[model samples]
Target: MFTKEKEFFSILFEAVSEGVIVVNTQQNIVATNQSAENMFGYNKKELETAPLIQLIPKNYHHNHHTYVNGFMKKNESRQMGVGRDLFGIKKNGDIFPVEVGLNPFTVRGETFVMALVVDITLRKQHQDQIQELNAKLEQKVIERTKELSEAVNKLKEVNAELDDENKKRLKAENKAKEALKKEKELNELKTKFLSLVSHEFKTPLSGILTSAMLLSKYKLEEQQQRRDKHIKTITDKVHYLNNILNDFLSIEKLERGKIQYNPSQFKISKVVNEVIYNANMMLKDGQIINYPENIDNYSIYQDEKIVELALSNLVYNAIKYSSENTVIDIKIKQNLDSTTFIVEDNGIGIPEKDQKNIFKRYYRAENALLTQGTGIGLNIVKSHLENLKGNIYFNSKENQGTTFWFSLPNKYQTKL
Candidate 1:
């Protein structure tokens, strides 16, 4: 019956897929299944009585004795090396990874250790392959990242270079535009200056020459009245020429920054009466200039001469442009902060297209070509008034009338 039970167990152990290795307390292999033999590269029934160390690597023989003695002393059954990997040796001196479960039992009053061994060579090889592939993949990713970083750096450098170039190009363009504008302004000044000198001098010189020639014919003492008329005409022409020269001189001083401005407190009505008295000298037949009644007592603190020049220019324009029997109205309005001077005339009004350019240097309205003017009065007045912190604007309708309004800040400082 004992033999029958042993045969039954051997058959049962042989059917297991894992190798069943049985060892005595002395660590000698007492029994091994066919699976154990096959796992260690052994033939059938060839592993009996072999020292268990023979199946371990030569380097692991001393450790195996300690492990077996510890296991026997502990008298507990468990897996070998629970938290670590295990290694195994084959009959042909080959080493491979393994997993081991140990069982201890007393069979017929003898102690024995049963080791359940699984040859995990293929699993270890697959793990090694996976680790190698992962290492290669990691290296590739690092290289690719480096290349992308380099590319991004290069793109940034290129963009920086492009921005610098764009800024330089914009600066060059702005410089060119400024240069062109200055050159155009210079050319315009030259052309208009020549035109003004030619027109102004030619008319006055012709008048003086004509009057002198007529006065030469009236040399007899009885022609005194006729000679006096010619003398008066000559005097007026000389005065007109002198006024033109003064306008040119003012422009030169303005350009050279040499004009001196003096600010003082002056009564508005005083300035008004003075300007109206002078403007009355140039009034035509049946024409009259009417100022508002009871002018305000506001005392403006500003360059009184500039205000006079501006007002004189406006009233002079009104008297020169209007027809006979037309009434020119001078209106004055004062706010708390500013003073307004309005000169309204029923005259040959400015053309719509000509009004915008009326204040430009040497600009004359086409309708006023026959009139006696050098076209410098309004521009000079405008510049002087601006220096005094004032502004001028006008309203006009063709063949109807013209109204010019200029404003002055009640409080201002002289700009030297």
Candidate 2:
């Protein structure tokens, strides 16, 4: 029965997870379990004489001694895992996290301290791993912030470049506009110079031509052919000079708003015939003039002189711009309350982009630059037609042909 009781108590002490040790007030270990021997790296026989301070790290030995002395003086119990971090030194001199509990007891007038110690190394390792991960996460966040800052800076640089490009574009556009305005002023000056020269020369030129014609009547028979040739030269020169003078004078009057319109009744057929006859004089040898047969004998109320000038300008332009031996078509028709005049030509047509400004003063189609023109012909025609409450329009295809149309009121038309 005694062996059974001793075996039961030994089994109970050895089975405890905590290492247990009992020490006297002198700090020498009096009793210990198998767990305590294994925890402190001491055999049961060695533990009998071992000092309790042997289980403490060298750095913590003095403090532990002081605490134990104080606890013994107060005769109180102490708990572990509350006041400070506690660690123990193993036989291998390796330090490990631990929790220590102390209980003081008196039996038979002998004082002893019961100590319970647990290994906490696994918990401490877990805490350390979490701390390490948190530090790594914080570092990653800092790197990401740096990347974002760099991206924002690059975006700012791009925006700056765009702003600079916009400024340059605007400057280039302004410079181009200024250049266009200066070119327009220069063209106006050239037109004025041509007008002045033509005006000063036309009167003398006409007088010379007339005198030459009169001289033709009384000529030596031997020199008669020479006289005829000279007369023809003078007439041609006068005719060319008259055309130049007329273009200039028309532009000047239109600019000064001095064109007078006298609307009157005129035979449409007679006017059409006269214009056709004049146009034929300038046609190439094989070029044909097609006129509508039997145009309506409608008496149109409009400025006869202005209408005739406008028609002549259109026919002359058609002949000037077309290839040699090409056909020019003229048609006149009477509508219910209006008269229509159409001039069609197979020529180098105005470009689509330039057609809008074709009627503007001083504006010429790019294709018409080689032709001798002041660019004021269509502008004058538009003004004269407006005064008579008429409308004029044109259709053209580049490299194909052009067709121009004008509609005048058959009678006196009101404000359009």
Candidate 3:
């Protein structure tokens, strides 16, 4: 029966496609399948009882014993040579890449290890071919990525133009026709506003792109200041774009009657500080904001977000219309029924004729038509204020300056 069992083992082992070699505790080859003998360029019975090192590359011989000893102690099955390449030597001394799996077992109180080996030269060659193909395609991949980015930017610009046109068309259709002359004036304004929109978007987008390109050139530690300058330009451009988008959204909400005011008690200083912090980023050379005095103790029981938005529009407008080396003053006056916030700037102000229509939607002053503005911020602010029992008013003189002020009720009583 023992002889029959040994014969059965031999038959099964030899049937395996991979090379198999069994080693004793002394690291001598105890048995080998025909596949192992053929793989190592040896005849039948040639590898029996030979040192396992005879089949390993010469450089690996020094550490082979330690590895076998560790594997024997662990006495488990696992793949050999993880995270590294392994090689085998043939009987004629030809070296080739190989993958190896090891299994430890015991028979008749003797410990032995079985090594399963597979030649991997073909797999290694395939991997090298794939890497070479990737290297050749790298430049094409980069060009394609750049083309995709430019296409996306162009799409954004087209979409913005379309959105502005749609808004204008909708507004014109909704308005009551006072006279044919007024309708003709409205059409002319729409055309001019469309041109302004194009200029406004393209100008900042071009600045952002230029700044971004310049930023990549300033890579050295010593060029940090240059990098920061470009970074600031990008940031300011992005902020301006965001404000325009917010203004559009505000217009849409107002037209749809979807504005919802959520009232909550909040410190007035908190809102003031945020507005000044953001405004500081847009300050011209030698310009400064004169922050309101000692309002840290004041609180407001109204819609904090609306108040902040109204304040931000006024402060931003003051900054935009102001000149270099100027001061913008912000003052807060709290009373029993309402609180008034003031933003005064020494810059281009509304013309006497444009002052009456300043709060009208999409109305830019004749003197300020060339400036970068959407002309909807004040309209949105006024609408929000009146809806919440507040009021907004301003005083201006052409070529002098402007002071815009808005007041909100101390405790808002919902009208909707």
lDDT for every model?
Answer: 0.87, 0.80, 0.88
Return the clash pairs for model 3, or none: none
Per-residue C-alpha lDDT of model 1 across residues 171-220, encoded as one tens digit per residue: 99999999999899889978977977888799889999999999989978
Please list the residue runs of candidate 2 whose C-alpha ends up more than 4 Å from where it truly belongs after superposition.
1-230, 413-416
Model 3 poorest ten-residue lDDT run: 1-10
Choose 1 or 3, whichever is better by TM-score. 1
Those runs of model 1 whose alpha carbons end farther than 4 Å from true positions after fitting are 1-150, 219-224, 414-416
Best by lDDT: 3
Q: With candidate 1 superimposed using the best TM-score fit, by how many Å does residue 182's alpha carbon deviate from the native?
A: 3.4
Query: In candidate 1, what residue range of length 10 has the lowest lDDT sum?
Result: 1-10
Q: Name the candidate, 2 or 3, with the larger lDDT value.
A: 3
Candidate 2 residue pairs that clash:
none
Clashes of 2: 0
| Model 1 quality (TM-score) | 0.70
TM-score, every prediction: 0.70, 0.48, 0.53
